[model samples]
Target: MWTVGHSTHPLEDFVALVRAHGVHHIADVRKMPRSRRHPQFNVDTLPAELGSAGIGYTHFAGLGGLRREQPDSVNRAWKNPSFRAYADYMQTAMFAAELDRLIALGAREPVAVMCAEAVWWRCHRALIADALVARGEPVLHIHTPQRAEPHVLREFARVENGRVTYPGEPELF
Candidate 1:
């Protein structure tokens, strides 16, 4: 499995980007699959566009970002509030079910999870990648048509019993 970002690319370029990674299915992980800046990626048109290219598309809103942070979140390793919030969301049963669905899809096909951010490190896909890695799934972050880097667990990430948590405290991580 892999993760890619459309990043305002033209439709053809985005398709090529996924094709380069042998991704036959794209599990769109955007909370809202619309792009005012790049309408070509809007949900209404993307499925058809990707279909013509022989790549499948499915929107996994359950794995979407922009979640609200729990006031009691312990994922302080992420100074960025959004990342901290998303880490908390990962603990939900909803997230586990959604992630299981994604893993099942990957078993049947080469899957690429995608969002809007150009860089994986800056996207919620980073945390998603962490969860995947903790489960022993290989995840690569696609950077270009010819370049992809395998995801490495973040420095502060701690995995216990197949769950990953980022406790900011250096002593515990």
Candidate 2:
């Protein structure tokens, strides 16, 4: 499986990148699938464009980001509030279900989870990649038409019982 960010790429360039990588299905993992800045990546247009290139598109809002951190979130290692919130959401059944769906799709065809951010580490796709790795699926971050990187689990991530968490330092009395 792979992850790609639309990242301001022109529509043709984006489609070419996916086609070059042999991605047959694209699972849109953006909370809001439409992009005002890049109308080509908007939901109403993306599917048809991808279809024209023989690629499939599906939006998985259940796996989307823009989550709120719980007041008592245990995944504190992520200093970024947005990242922390997403990490907390990963512990929920909704995330598990959506992740399962993504995995199942990947099992059938080459699939790439896509978001808007250009870099995987800067996007929630990094967290999703961690979850996929914990589930034994190798993931690749698609950087450009000629460049892709293998996903490495976040250094601070802790996985137990197949679930991942990022705990901050213990309180010092």
- Best candidate (score: TM-score): 2
In model 1, where do residues sit more than 4 Å from their true spots? Answer: 170-173
lDDT of 1 by residue, 31-139 (tens): 9999999999999999999999999999999999999999888787889999999999999999999999999999999999999999999999999999999999999
Quantify all predictions' global Cα lDDT against the true fold: 0.94, 0.93
Could you tell me every candidate's TM-score relative to the true structure? Answer: 0.96, 0.97
**Highest lDDT among the candidates is held by which one?**
1
- Over the stretch 49-125, how does candidate 2's per-residue lDDT look in tens digits? 99998999999999999999998898989999999999999999999999999999999999999999999999999
Candidate 1 displacement at residue 94 in angstroms: 0.3
Candidate 2: TM-score?
A: 0.97
